[model samples]
Target: MLDLVAVLLALGLLMYLAYRGVTLLILAPAMALLAALLTGGLPILGAYTQIFMTNTGAFIVSFFPLFMLGAIFGKLMDDTGSAKSLAGSVSAWLGPERAIVSVVLCCAVLTYGGVSAFVVAFAIIPVAAALFRAADIPKRLMPGALALGAFTFTMSALPGSPAIQNAIPMPFLGTTAFAAPGLGIITGLVMLLLGLAWLNRRAARARAAGEGYGAHADGVPGPDVAMREHAQGEGFDIAELSGDPAPGKPHRDGNLPPVALAVLPVVVVIVTNFAFIRIVIPMLDTAWLAEPLFGATTIESVRGVWAVIVALFFAILLLIAGNWRRLADLRASLDKGADASVLPIFNTASLVGFGAVIAALPVFDLISETVLGVGGGNPLMSVAVSVSVLSAMTGSASGGMSIALDSLGPTFVDLAHATGVSLDAMHRVTAVASGALDALPHNGAVITLLTVCKITHREAYGDIFIVACAIPMLALAVLIVLTNLLGSF
Candidate 1:
């Protein structure tokens, strides 16, 4: 069909652009515009834009405000010595025996707090290197292990995931984090087990296979070269080293408070999602968990926004209650937050925009439509493969999700509605696959960890690819078996 040909050309071009670092944030909506022009011409593009506005409402451009807030909260914590206080407390309790795991856990907590994956990777890799060497775990294990820790919960199923990889589909699918709590929890636990298992297996394989895989990308004799190289950056600033609260005077052990503060945003989003969708929305014409503040936005859009607001609110309260001890430095903290957020905000929006346009094209329609018919029988697998394929094509997990969120999201959901899959199952599987595959190539989280750990795609990424690419395939198979054999209830 001419429609199919036009669609393919657009998708191919979109993929090429995505590979060039244009990002799904920009690529998505832009592609949507292209697809419209190619398929139904300009009129269709106008209609889709109208639909986008209705979906985004007036708050489309403001979505990143929450991310900014979360970043601000993180900046304040670091500036005020809150983060270190929290890290120190936990390190003490964890002991040197489980130091690597402790670092990973700490990083995960911060990720939930809304820090970028790159920031987490850079900050935490050094800690992992120190702790792993301390525990006699060897440097090489740091990259894979750190990657595992950071990617596990955050990638798959964290509530209030600031990543936007998973949440972007919520408005269309009617699947909020609250709707699949049990599934997400189980998925996370399964991934953690798999990650730990891989660690043990890889260590054994390395011992058996000989570390002769060579010094690895960071050019070290061990797996840790990646981590070592990243930490060697331009000496430490005094501000970063000594912002601790008076060096002593009753701290939250430097571990618990920062950890808790960091994790609070995610918890608020996940827990509130269910209540907002199931309990509140049905009662009112429209429900915005953040309605009081932002006036009736969808939870997905508002989740990041509200959590950051809450983080800011709590951050300020903590600062004021702590007697405005760091009040003079507040301006410095704000600037730090803004500086870090610019890249993520710019990239994400552009990437999402591009995907929106491409999906609206005949190429997306033809591919999506064809996949829908094939996947109609085994929806979970269909969704997984599509996301992974797109991710690999784009080199970003979140980017891959953006592609599916536009072209495949509605198609898959409609198929599920028509076929026999439960909405909850579909939602859970979608998030899991998105998080999992995002582990490969362009996944910012995986890339950050690798860059810091000084490992290369050849050495460590193969391991991640195995897990990210393979697990979702396995999950899809299982879902197919369960739904087909056991039947959806």
Candidate 2:
């Protein structure tokens, strides 16, 4: 039908424009209206205000705290030099002889601690570069290593991760951030191990091929004007978030915090998040949550967000307390971090808005029916395919996940119930699915990473594709099978 054709055209244009560097702030709404106009007989203004803005506003309202606090936490880690310190220590301890593993772990530690992936890429690249050069490893593999650690396991598959990917499913599924902890741990390890195997094998082949960290007149590309624009649109302005000494050069360990002190805040994020999710929130007197004033939502619906917010809050305080003297400009760090969350949250919310408008069209009923029918009524498989396709189309894990959940979340939840699929398992599958295909070449994170490393896609993208895209999808498949067998244990 023409409506379906219009929907596809709008999506294609959105993806093309976004990849071409148009800001989603403008692009998302414009795409929504374009689709609305083509649909015919639809009130375009009502689509924008009633459907689009309503969804966008609701997403922001529910998620802004996590975005703000998470950004602030990553900024504090960067400014206090804790991120650099932690990364440096990990690489040093692992040594360049294990160059790939060391770099991967450095990213994993920082990202698992609630630091943004953009911040992690910037922070770890210096240590990784130094290690790669020293170990005679190929520099082209650096992005893959970073992607494996920061982009794959820690960002999604790990239990209790404060990453927005993991948190996005909570309200929809009535599950916590630590949902399906056992399965999460298993999937995380599968991704880490499988990705490492692939990267290490490539390194061995490169070693045979006589390619050493190849010469580059340009050191690590600074977050130049163009890179900064793309990065800012995605989220935190990494150029502003980045500190002195530039990116490629390693920081002096003497100026950095002791490794123990540097790592504590990250540990605090995980521990406190777990504690709140398991203990604190449940014990609260929250019968009032059912009142209409509170949106008539249950405690389960809000507890996951609350847990992550509180964990990040306490972690931020700990970073400040422990690094007080180290913080050169505390106010500036807080402001920049808070400011960083705004664009990213809005960007993703707009994507959700775009999806909302499209869903309001008659064609969406057909689309949703098809999506829900996938896997022959298997909710896990259905969700995996739905989230993955949307993520690939949008080139954003959070944005795509939000759009998928915004449109089909309730339907999936009902499917889970009827099929006796555990919501916790469904939550884990949804999170993993988002991170799977969002790593395509046009992805903002992928582009910013290649730009920062100064490696062209032609040179390094093959390795990145293996580790970030192919390997994570393999891990997701494994997760689906395990969830089916184990049933959310």
TM-score on alpha carbons, each prediction: 0.72, 0.96
Q: How well does model 2 score by local distance difference test?
A: 0.87
Which parts of model 1 are misplaced by more than 4 Å? 1-62, 81-92, 97-100, 158-163, 205-328, 472-489
Number of the top-ranking candidate, with lDDT as the measure? 2
| lDDT (Cα, tens digit) per residue for candidate 2, span 257-331 | 789999999999999999997888868899999999999999889999999999999999999998887776788
Instruction: Please list all clashing residue pairs in model 2, or write none if there are none.
Output: none
lDDT at position 266, candidate 2: 92
Q: Which parts of model 2 have CA positions greater than 4 angstroms off?
A: 218-220, 231-254
- Superposed on all Cα atoms, the candidates' RMSDs to the truth, in angstroms, are 6.7, 2.3
TM-score of 2: 0.96
Maximum-TM-score candidate: 2
